[model samples]
Target: MVAIDPEPLLAAGRLAHEQLMNDACTITRVGPPTLTRGTSVLTPGASTTLYSGACRVKPQRIPRNEQASERLTVVARYEVALPFSSVATDDLQVGDTVTITASGDTRLVGQKFAVMAVDFGSHSTAWRLTVEGAT
Candidate 1:
């Protein structure tokens, strides 16, 4: 039996998958915070733009009781998926932030989320990120 290279298949799959990623998001890597005197300051290092382009953002299905009391609580979590060509995986780290710059759903625009985890696979079409909403 002859062997078939998976590169072509992967490429085609990514192309088709990326089309569904209609949302536009900007991923920014934030530096660690510093402390002045006895108080901790949130003066993170110079923010860097890691990735900014088409992506998919979806809220994870969780129990209602797990959510906060308020409807628009900052504790909400979401999963973000971006095309592989759009970002270098190494540039994305935990604590980085993702902001929805544009989306067909107006409600998603301007929302910010902190990266909690990164998920990728050999056969994956897009990189998945678990993020929590910020206030």
Candidate 2:
């Protein structure tokens, strides 16, 4: 019996996955201390670009209003997937915002989504992020 090496197969799978992540998405970290203004006051943190690369973004279902008096609002929820090499699990937080742009058009840019959940796949295969519209 002969054992075949699996390196080539894994490489091919990684290549194919990368090709599908053609869309661009930026993950910005907004929670780190920037400067100290006074003895006890710390200035608001600045937006730091954590990850910027190709990703797959899909719009999740919007919740339906149950009552007529309640104003119906579309809460844009999205599932974003990116190569595991692009970002570390600890790099993203719940309040981080992911801005997505389509085909270099600003008009079609989706709403800024706040990170609700971060799913870091085992073995670092990928990162699946569940995000919702920032209120």
Candidate 3:
């Protein structure tokens, strides 16, 4: 009986994933918000950049619209994939924010998203993040 090593396969997968990513993204860990008069204020204390590099951003779902009176709200969901070695698996949190600094699609650039979930596994070639934002 022989045991085959999986490192080579994993390395190849990582390389392929990196080559497909055409966008630049930045992940930021935001500081705790301040509470004032029983309300949470979004005044950011300090932020740390967890990762900044090439990434792939894909639309998870079509933008949905909700109308209230004369105001309309549109919500968009996206999935971001980063190279396996882009950042440590434990460094990203659910509440962390991802900003797409540059992308081949002009509409995607300068868009910010709130991280809703992080997906990773031993065999994962890239880190997948589910994010949502108002379009």
Q: Give the clash count for model 3.
A: 0
Count the clashes in each prediction. Answer: 0, 0, 0
Positional deviation of 116 in candidate 3, in angstroms?
A: 0.5
Q: Where's the lowest-lDDT run of ten residues in candidate 1?
A: 63-72
Better model by lDDT, 1 or 3?
Answer: 3
Per-residue alpha-carbon lDDT of candidate 2 for residues 10-118, written as tens digits (9 for 90 to 100): 6676677777776788889866676655676767778888787778777676744333466555566778888756635456878888888653445426657889988
Candidate 1 matches the true fold with a TM-score of 0.78
Give the residue spans of candidate 3 off by over 4 A. 34-43, 67-69
Candidate order (TM-score): 3, 1, 2
TM-scores of the models, in the order given: 0.78, 0.68, 0.83
Candidate 1 regions exceeding 4 Å error are: 34-42, 63-74
User: Judged by TM-score, which candidate is best?
Assistant: 3
Better of 1 and 2 by TM-score: 1
Backbone collision tally, model 1: 0
Instruction: State residue 76's C-alpha deviation in candidate 2, in Å.
Output: 2.8
Q: What is the alpha-carbon RMSD of candidate 1 to the true structure?
A: 3.3
Cα displacement (Å) at residue 113, model 1:
0.7
lDDT of 2 at 15: 72
